[model samples]
Target: MSAKIEVIKNKILSENWFVLRNFTYDLTTKDGTTLRHRREVYDRGNGATILLYNREKNSIILTRQFRIATWVNGNENGMLIEACAGLLDNDSPEECIRKEAIEETGYAVGKVEKLYEMYMSPGGVTELIHFFAAEYDEGLRANAGGGVEDEDIDVIEIPFPQAWAMIKTGQIRDGKTVMLMQHALIEGWLSLT
Candidate 1:
């Protein structure tokens, strides 16, 4: 059974970067109890992410960048390794991921296979990320991708075994990247032999 909810009030808290709104709503429980709740939600629009892998070489491409949020939280250096991802903006999920792959990894990827969509943080953030994967090779190299505007990204291509081990060693800590890597492993797309 799903609970019913109705918005009582919504006010803009901030829009410096994206949008932050304070919402007051009444949530009716299954037992007919209605409770008024107030919450602040951040809406930065939706996004998409992709993992680029080469089956023959058993290697995958990832990016390293400094994330301010992680730094403020606990990460000392805030340097994080993540799959190529970006906001959807006005493009479709597939199109957005394809563009992001090129902008972040320099790979004009071939046929892409969408894996799934997920809400990374549903409690306060309203971002639904579309996940995808594609095979890549040297023939698809478009440019030396390091992000477009203010983004400073470093592209890294590592062997599947080493990359996978980074998860245990706490090197690869991004959620979306970890999920995509695990999916590739389970699907036998990361087999060396």
Candidate 2:
């Protein structure tokens, strides 16, 4: 079944960081019923994320940062452990993630395997995140990465078992990180032995 949508109006509510617009539209469903609704949409463009792992070391790279949104929403300290991620801006998904890995984790990754693309929040945010995985080693460390500019990020390298257990302990609640870790587990990309 397909739903036909017609925009009645699009009013820009805010244009500070990204964009927030109010959309009034008429949706005609397959049942021939038409309904008018208003919704707010946040457009921050697309993004890319990568899970960097070291098979030989049996470890993975993750970043910890303060997310204001989570803080206001009941997160105690707002510090979140997440996969290396960044907005695409003017770069392709692969290019963005590769660059992000270096900038955020100090690893200039090679041979990235793109897992898939997903919409983290399709209801309000118009951002599609391209997911990827790559192998890393000490030889690839270009710098003591803590992010550039005003971004303060902590690059943490944890053993595969410990990192996987973080999920159960709620220490790693970031969706992208969880997904990548699960993917690695399901595909036997890392193991305890």
lDDT of each: 0.94, 0.95
* lDDT by residue (tens digit), candidate 1, 65-115: 999999998999999999999999999999998898889989999899989
Clashing residue pairs in candidate 1 are none
Report the C-alpha lDDT of model 2 over 1-193, residue by residue, as the tens digit. Answer: 6679999999999999999999999999888899999999999999999999988888999999999999999999999999999999999999999889999999999899999999999999999999999999999999999999989999999999999888899999999999999898888888755
Which regions of candidate 1 are displaced past 4 Å?
Answer: none
TM-score of each: 0.96, 0.97
Instruction: Please give the lDDT score at residue 17 for candidate 1.
Output: 98
